[model samples]
Target: MLILKQLILGLLLPAVVGGGIFIFAKSLAWKKESEQKKARLSGWLVAVALSAGYTVGYTGLEGLPPFPPREGVHWLCYLSIIGLISGAFWHSSRWGRLIVQIALSIVIPRLLLNSAFKYTWGQFEGIIWWMCLAVAVFIFWHIVQESFTILPAGGSSPFVYFGLSGGTALVLAVSGSLRLAQHAGILVAIFAASWVITFVRQRSDNNKWQVFPLGASPVVALLLLGIWMNGYFYEEVPAASAILLAIALFLAPVGRIEKIQRLGARRSAIVQICVIALPVVIAIGIAVARSGLFGESSSY
Candidate 1:
């Protein structure tokens, strides 16, 4: 009974409410042209509604007259809801929407669900979990399906938003002690490659990315991952690490292609290096410090 209630409250409720807003936004977009404006409004509405309702439910509602409260696992569940709402609010483009839904569907739920597994079942249970990872894979496949459209230049592409979030997660992971962090780092690298592919496509058709939302995905990824992981990783990001992640995320694209010769584009290499390297260094430092590999705790 409790598990059923939780599933409804955590997954179904947000999907219904948030999905309704998305559908409405789609209708509005079809009627009008300025997708950005409509997207902004829809994003704001979804964010506010989800955040407010989540706060109320987690704090007051939950289990009728309310028992004491489930501890860590339940908190992750609630945070996943918050992350979903925030993702919807943060992204503007259609691709961004698709990527966010993928993250919400897979990353957020898995983080919480995995933690639940650790508590309920002994050990990390990777094999069984891998089987369960069908959920994340399904979400990823759907993201590819719903969002992929031919870029101006060549082939179909996954949304830039997915690349952004995945990249951010990888950067943060590079900065931590966990092996998952390294995998995240690799994913970011792959995503970066894909971003370059997109840039090439856009440039070929003379459509440069005029403005990029810099901090939204990375920041949100960190926040959501942090909350989901119970603050396990990236507790301390070095100044250099933070700067590098920022640069890598911020620049890199224009650096590769001279066609994108905007002011920001000019400094692409520097930014890209900083974005990729700074956070990684910081994360390593933190790991060493925590493990006392260096002196009595090196500040990451």
Candidate 2:
């Protein structure tokens, strides 16, 4: 019963709401280009709505306390909602977009650290970790955003990226923590449904493939947050293994490699898959070895 409720509230409701918004936005604009912008906005709406729905579904409305000391989930839900609103209006200005991304980069990592380690702001180690995480997230944001501009139309679709993310979520679920895995499952549903809507709308207009940060940001946040939780809170998964898995995800952009980029899309994708898989395999091996699932004598 709980699972059914979560599926309906977390997955079904958000998909309907997001799809409805996309269709309505399309109706409001007569021009194809204008409709594309609206579509992007609708994607942002889906990301925010999904985040909110997952929060409410997973942790009841009352689960979140007032403020000051917020949980990791609260930070994810609230920052995502606030960031979506700010991004919608501020996307036109370069500086505004940068400021918003930077704020989220700092806040998300700090919130995770607090939730996991319960470290005070005055602690030097905590501060250093926060700074490092913030920088890593900022770099990831830039990489994803840049991919939209760098990749040719239809070269690498958002669906592919989202699918990769979902796979990572599944991996985390199996090897790390079940609770975090559930959240990742919800995220997969959200992205999959939202991607379908965007793909259909683009097909109707014959538009080129493009993925805005609006759709990508929340997935990035969920992936990073899930990894952190698994590494710090879950005992089965080593912190180093989690970090390696997170780093492996970045290999999707292997097309950027000059030699690889020279290959056709089909070949490039194959290479990218190999690149991404190698590290994931290594991470999983490390986790299994560390866990001593096979035998006590196994070491690596």
Candidate 3:
């Protein structure tokens, strides 16, 4: 019953609330349209809707946040608010967005890894680990947002993330922490909401993403990174699985070539999702085999 409730509330709440926000935003005449068309042109709206859904669904699942946030996972709530504000206002300037991205890179790794740095590792080790992670976050965020601009219209980005979240959830479930898995699962719901909305709304639009809702990129990226960081460092996820899962979303843009684009919107999205599925499927299979979910010994 508890599992069913989590699935029910976790799945439905984010989808319903986030879907409502998307619909509302879609209805508004934000401004003039160019000769070329785009779908969900307002990135901040995407960020707002997804972030709001995450915050609300998180509350529903875990109840209210305690003062000072006793758990590091709880920090996502506050960081998301920060991400939303930064994403919403900085949509117009490229350099403005880059600055925000760099600042977050510096903060989030240490933010989630303070105790690990101070108590678990030596100074040199901590600095080395922090530098690599910060750099990776910066690069990943840059690629995803850039993809939003370059990739042909088809809502492929949301589809990629939806698949990524589902893969992460399954991997986390088999990694000895259902708690962490549920966190990833919340993201699954949020992206699923976006996936449906984007796929529907972009049926005719095929312009380059000008004034696109690129804001959702960082929010989605941060959630995935934070989940993996917490799961591996603080929970039971293996280092190998963590590495594999972290790079999974990087394959998202591989299917954006001219050939795939000519396949049309729906088919193009399918190709992109399939490309992303390579890493996700491998990670899930490895995680399941490692944990012996089917009652057999296996290797990671």
TM-score per candidate, chains pooled: 0.35, 0.73, 0.86
Please, what are the lDDT tens digits per residue for candidate 1 over residues 88-155?
55554667755665565555444545545655554556546644554533433343222222121221
Q: On residues 1-300, what C-alpha lDDT tens digit does candidate 2 reach at each position?
A: 977876776667655654455345434433446655765665565445555545543443225544664555445455545545664554466787788778878877766566444644557777787788788778777765555555445424445555545655555554546655555555566557657766776678677444443454544454445445544544355665667666765776677788997898668767776676677667666766766667762433
Question: Against the true structure, what is every candidate's RMSD?
Answer: 15.1, 4.2, 3.3
**Clash pairs for candidate 1:** 170-184, 175-283, 241-278, 241-279, 244-274, 244-275, 245-275, 247-271, 248-275
Top candidate (lDDT): 3
Give the alpha carbon lDDT tens digit for every residue of 112-217 in model 3: 8878988898999999999999998898777767767655455566666777888888888988888878878888888788777766665545432332366677
Poorest 10 consecutive residues by lDDT, candidate 1: 149-158
Model 3 misses residue 244 by how many Å?
2.3
Order of models, best TM-score first = 3, 2, 1
| TM value for model 2 | 0.73
Please list the C-alpha lDDT of all candidates, in the order they appear.
Answer: 0.40, 0.58, 0.74
- Candidate whose TM-score is highest: 3
